[model samples]
Target: MRMIAAVMYEQGLPAPYAESSPLKIEEVELEGPGEGEVLVEVKSAGLCHSDLSQVAGLRKRTVPVVMGHEGAGIVREVGRGVTEFRAGDHVVMTVGSGCGHCSFCVNSRPVLCDTVAASRGKGVLTNGARKLRRNGQALFHHSGVSSFAQYAVTVPGTLVKIDPSVPLEIASMFGCAVVTGAGSVFNAAQVRPGQSVAVFGLGGVGLNSVMAAKIAGASTIIGIDLNESKLPLAAELGCTHALSALDPTLVEKVRDLTHGGVDFAFEISGSKAAMTTAIAVTRKGGEVVCVGLGASADLYQYAHTALVSEEKVFRGSLMGSCVPRRDLPLYLRYYQEGRMAVDRLMSGTMGFDQLNANLDLLDRGEVLRQVLLPNG
Candidate 1:
């Protein structure tokens, strides 16, 4: 079938993406799902920094790829032998997929599966097939999702069925930011009620961590970021205290605010400095969860003795150590119970025509979470 998609034809485009138009909206050909795959009509997709990183050369990938990972859509068709989902089902797309028999997939850790790792790195599906074409030329898939288009062909593992009544725009964020942030708190840190917590970087992901900490009954929840503008939103979401990460005494202030140090500190900014600060703000034997995705070459540095003597735990969380099948519905129920504020996370919504403008806002940290209506 014919469809329209935002295709990244090249990388390292000039900034002010609203004017440069890095992704070209063009007519493309989409193939129907084959065996074990499903076709979905993407209703709401969020513009995430990971997508921005790809277009800005901060991350490299196969060019001419349809880029988007955080999205919610309705199933339009299911391929043969697929019994888990059918037409009309609402689903949240996950970033990874794996062969079911693998040790990681058997244990509900698909992100670590070699199949997902190899495919996502090459911008292909789990089966290594390209389902998109521009005038008969193949196009790479983005994280096996490629949801920036009106329609997407993905494997069943990449989707989790959701309640249809849930608003697609808000549901879109569950795929990435919510899972990464809340999962970092609940799954990675195993935060206990009444514990003190601190989150670094108040973007969509960081703010969600703040909300999760509050839901966990944290006594103190602090949000730290370089941008002052994001602090107010952080407070509104659930942060009990907010501060600029640029302050020379930021770490000291965190320790003082918590009456010593927080029990748990999360680094969601993907910056080396933020990671350093996250580790520094934790009390002795405290746990620090790193949920940020920075450049591959970047590394975090800290004194080696601190790990053994302090008994501080440093954990790297990927997709919040989430099993989408088990976690997405858990989060949706939290939203329904009014315990999670997924609605407040979205700052704006737009159509494919406004894609470039929204991308610019994301690059500038001018929006928390923006939804894209690809069908428009």
Candidate 2:
């Protein structure tokens, strides 16, 4: 099949992506699902910071890859041995797919599956196949999704069937932002009633963390960010206080607000400086959960002595330590019940023509949760 898709041939392009135009909109070839694979007609794909990192060369992947990881669509066809999903079923495609028999998958930690790690590192499907091509030249898949097109072929583990009633645009976020952010709170931090929470970086993921904190009954939730514009939405979502990450006394203020620091601090900005601040604002015996993906070589330095003496835990959360099959539906249920309010995160929708400009917008912190209507 032929489809229009955004293909990235290089990384670390100059800023003002609208001008540099790192992503080229072109017609590409898509192969049908083979054994254990599924074909989906993409309805909506979200522009996430992780995708931005790839564009900026902060994260490296195989070149000439279709650049999208979070999306929602309808199953158009199912390959052999796939009985869980059928044609026309609504689904959310996640990058956190795991081989179900791995130790990580069996323990409800598919995000850490060994097979997925190796495949994603090589930019191929779990079964080592590349289903995208342009003019007979194969293109690498992005996190096994490659959803920045009208259609995608992926394995069943990468997809989670969803209620058909949910809007695809809203459901798109569940694949990454919602699952990573909300899952960080519900699964990683495990905030209990009246626990104090602080979330660094109020983008889609941080905002979701704020909402999850509220749902988990956190008594005090402080939202931090460099962008003042994002703070208002954070407060609206569930933050009891919204503060600038640039404040000179930010740590002091958070500690005072939470009466000696928060129980859990989430770092979602993909900034090492933010990670340090997140750690500083966490109470003794508290946990600092890092959810953002920064430059691979960027090392985070912290007070090791304090970490030991205070018993503070520094943890890295990938895909919110989520088991997509188990958790996405539960989070969707939260959205359905009106407790998550993820709809507020939507900035707007875009098409292929607006792709590069929207990347600039996201890079400049000018937008939040922009969806690409590839089929439109």
Candidate 3:
């Protein structure tokens, strides 16, 4: 089928993407689902920082690719041997696509699945197939789910069946920001009741951490970000304390607020500086969870002695170390119970034509999350 979708021809275009328009909307051909895959009519997709990074050349992908990873949709058709779903089923797609037989997959860590991880960067399905084309020329998929388009073909494992009652626009975030953010807190950090927590970077991911910490019964939840515009929303999303990342006493402030640093510090800012701050704000024996995916060339420099002397634990969390099939439902339950706030986290919603404008806002940290309604 031929459909209109955003395609990236090149990366790192100059400011005012309106002129360069790195992601160009074009009529492209979409392939149907093959064996073990499904075709989805994308209802809504979110503009994430990771997508912006790809546009800015911070992350590389196959050019002429449909560029979106976070989305929710209705199953239009199921491929051969697929019995778990059928037409009209609502679902949220996950970025991780693993070979079912892999050790990581069996261990409940599909994000680290060897084959899927490799295939994602190569711009193909887990089965090493391309599902997009333009004028008979193949176009690569983005992260195995090119949701920027009207339709997407993905492996069965990449999707998690969800309650159709859930709004697709809000549900789209669960695919990336919510899962990665909340998972980092509940699964990776495992914050207990009355524990103190601090989250750096108040984007969609960091804000979700703040909300999860509050729901987890945290005594204090601190949010930090360079963008002052985001501080207020962070507070509204359950942050007990909001501070500027620019404050010279940023670390000291957190230490003071938590009365000797927080028990858990989450680095979701995707910055080396924020990673340093996350470590510094944690009390002795505290754990610092790195949740951001920054530039490949960037490095986190720290004193190795601190790890042993302070007994501080530093861990990297991918996809919130989430088991999507299990975690996605749990998160939705929180939202249903009003314990989580996915709706308030959404800054705005726009049509697909405004893709670049929304990307500019995300790149500037001016919005927590912007959902794109393809059919609108």
Candidate 4:
């Protein structure tokens, strides 16, 4: 089948992406699902910072790849040996696909699965196949989910069946922002009642972290970001205090607000300076959960002695350290109960024509979560 899709042929295009046009929209060939794969008609996909990183050349990926990983759609067909999902089932696509036999998969850590890692590194589906083509030439898959197109063929391990009642646009965020942000609070940080929390970066992920901390009963939730526009929404989403990341006394203010420092700090901005602020605002014996992806070679500098003596833990969280099959439903339940309020995070929806311009908006920190209706 031929479908309209956004294809990236190069990386590190100069900014003003509206002009650089890193992603080219064109008609491409999509193959049917093979063994253990499923064909999905993508209803909605989200433009995430990770996508921006790939466009800006901060993250390297195989060229000529369909560029989207966060999406929700309906399963149109199931391939051989696939019994868990079938035609017409609503589902959300995730980046963490695992070979069921791997140690990480068996240990309930599919995000770290060895097979998925290798396949992602090579930009192919977990089964080691490329299902996208243009002019009879193969195109690489993005995180096993080339969802920037109207349809996608992906492995079952990367999809989770969801309630049809949920809006596909809202559900699209669960794949990346919600899962990674909320999962950090619920699973990685494990904030308990009365714990103090600080979130550095008030984008979709950081806002979700704020909501999750509120749900987890955190007494104080501090939202930090360089964009003052996001501060109001952070407050609306359960942040007790919203502060500028650029403040000269930001660390001191956070420490004073939390009566020393926060129990857990989440770094979601992918900025090295934000990571430093996250670490500085965490109390002794506290933990700093790093959820953002920065440049491949960027190294975070911190006080090693303080890390050892204070027992402050700096941990890396991928896809929220989530087991998609187990956590997606639970997070969806939170959404259903009206506790998550994810809809508020959406900036707006756009089509392929505005995709590049939207990237410029995201680069300028003018939006939170932008949904792409590929089928439209």
Instruction: List residue ranges in candidate 4 displaced over 4 A.
Output: none
lDDT against true structure, model 3: 0.89
Cα-based lDDT for every prediction: 0.89, 0.93, 0.89, 0.94
lDDT of 3 by residue, 142-184 (tens): 8888889888999888899999999999999999999999999
Model 2 bad stretches (over 4 Å): none
- lDDT by residue (218-331, candidate 4, tens digit) is 999999999998998899989999999889999999999998899999999889888888999999999999999999998879999999999999888899999898999999
Q: Please list the residue runs of candidate 1 whose C-alpha ends up more than 4 Å from where it truly belongs after superposition.
A: none
Q: Model 1 over residues 297-348: C-alpha lDDT tens digits?
A: 7777987898789989988899888888888899899998998888988998
**Candidate 3 residue 109 C-alpha distance from true site, Å:** 1.2
Best by lDDT: 4
Cα lDDT for residue 218, model 3? 93
Clashing residue pairs, backbone N/CA/C < 3 A, model 1: none
Runs of candidate 3 with Cα error greater than 4 angstroms are none
Instruction: Single out the weakest 10-residue window by summed lDDT for candidate 3.
Output: 93-102
Backbone atom clashes (below 3 Å) for every candidate: 0, 0, 0, 0
